[model samples]
Target chain A: MNKKRIAIDMDDVMTDAIGRFIELYQQEFQEDLSDLRLPGRNLTNTVPPERLEAIKQYPHQPNFFKDLEPIAGSLEVVEQLHQRYEIFITTAALEFEHSFTPKYNWLKKHLPFITWKNIVFCGDKSIIRADYLLDDLDRNLKTFTGTGLLFTAPHNAHVTGYTRLNNWQEVAAYFLH
Target chain B: MNKKRIAIDMDDVMTDAIGRFIELYQQEFQEDLSDLRLPGRNLTNTVPPERLEAIKQYPHQPNFFKDLEPIAGSLEVVEQLHQRYEIFITTAALEFEHSFTPKYNWLKKHLPFITWKNIVFCGDKSIIRADYLLDDLDRNLKTFTGTGLLFTAPHNAHVTGYTRLNNWQEVAAYFLH
Candidate 1:
């Protein structure tokens, strides 16, 4: 049976979160945090450990969610895929306090087509079952048991192994074919 | 006076070396190294010292160069830029023995408009004095005193600092404007 469930990671996969965060951080702090490279996959390396922990403690930084820019072609791709598959927004950000509500609000505001019931915010996404997990993080792919499609991002595209895609159209082609 | 000389990196900026290497490595060794997570950028972990040394000593493998692909819009961009700038194909692949010859040959074969005389192979690129250096490697960008335009690749696109471009069209637009 072709499992039609599709799970997507939020940060770089759906929304340009890391890019927006770095832009905001630099504007506010006058500090360039773009070169802070983190090991592993995804936006996990955008901020230092201390800062990440601090953000987690107080997740409601004004305009943090508002600042998010959707990845190019994401809304269109999601809309197309949703027709054939059960789409779920499975993000690691769900683990942090006040994570889901703000993200949900952001999505609702930007993409009203995505239903609230379809979103699944959780810290650990590997535990959730799905046919395909489109993620920018390598660690998350390692944890996921399903077919993992690594979204090509500036950070994770160089990573070797796993299926790599330049954009969501490619992802749709891969699964739909 | 702005130096009219333009020095371009060979790897991703000129020829698709990494793409070819990954393709061959997979075809020959059945080793799929598609992950963008190269050692220095991600993980505190290092590739085994022996493996690293082996790669260093491996007589710059030119097998991939035999079928190198030109990055999108590279020829058009170079042609347009050449009208206003003295274009130099500067690369650090000379350390790999005669590997650069094939790369040169491939460029000439594919991009016949680019003259071989304009190409300069050096052991280190940053030391080359030029008005501008278009490179994809961040390390090399740091070493150059000239204005640098980084070619965005799947892996290094996440780099925070420096001017980035997705394709040669973007590069041409930047320099021409």
Candidate 2:
């Protein structure tokens, strides 16, 4: 039997991109973002209007995604999942052009088990073909033909309807257990 | 009604990568390759064995894919196809990691009509989802779930089984007409 294939999103699902954004915001404006979580929205509201452009340029910077820490339990759970399933690191890397090399390097450094052959850097997630897609964006999941597993992020706390995996441990429980 | 999607390959189907290889070979060794068409095989057979390493490095060069001219009539035919079909430029770009930026820039420069959202930089074509895939490699087509249209490239001249599109005009005839 063919092993089930899973297309995994990178940004917030695999790595803490928002956490990095929060870190950048704190370093730039010296503001504590303790109460920044807003349901059904991203941290954009927390960012000052005057500094919005600077926040936008963060992803465009070289090595922006290089040193990002993977989401809690993601590295271990995803590595275990790789043993049983054909997992692809399907990231919408085209949105930030400079993220291509850095993201590829980050994967190589952190998730060494994933071969370059299984890494896809694309724009739209709709063209992906897999048994399941684990993404933070409902927009991506809505267009997918396969089963969509909503990977919870602060921005999508209010979003519902799909099977939600709140964390990498939940992902492991849903798939492995 | 949802429009049928067609995933198109880049290297040989849309641009003449092998032709560029031939030009580079002639310039490097100063040998006229006028009779180099080996029919079933690629121009690699024509290159001296000692120079094979150099030939392999061509794709790794920073601007290798930047200035590659599109195949005759490809620009026109693909642009026309975009009007009716949800077209995506799906390329195995990870094989040459340096090719990401150049390939993306190349598409942006020549195929401005095709948005960045429609472009995909991937390694394996098997992960692609669409109604049809137009590619030169039989391996890619074999693994694809969609109908495969074998775009005639010199290396794949002997390859048969899928519907063959010898040129852009043939592609237009197959799809548009």
TM-score of every model?
Answer: 0.43, 0.95
Report per-candidate DockQ: 0.01, 0.83
Candidate by candidate, in order, the iRMS in Å equals 26.3, 0.8
Q: Model 1 over residues A90-133: C-alpha lDDT tens digits? A: 66542343344457667677667666445554444544457788
Per-model clash counts, in order, read 14, 0
Residue B156 of model 1, lDDT score: 73
- The local lDDT score (0 to 100) that residue A90 gets in candidate 2 is 94
lDDT of 2 by residue, B1-177 (tens): 988999999998888787777777788778766445456765567667887788879888777787888899999999999899999999998888888888888898889988878888888889999999999999999999989999987778888799998899999999998
Q: Taking the tens digit of each residue's C-alpha lDDT, what string does model 2 give over A1-177?
A: 999999999998988887777777788779876455455556576666787787889888776787898888999999999999999989998888889888888889989989888989988899999999999999999999999999998788888889999899999999998
TM-score of chain B of each: 0.79, 0.94
- How good is model 2 by TM-score? 0.95
Model 2: CA > 4 A from native: A34-41, B34-38
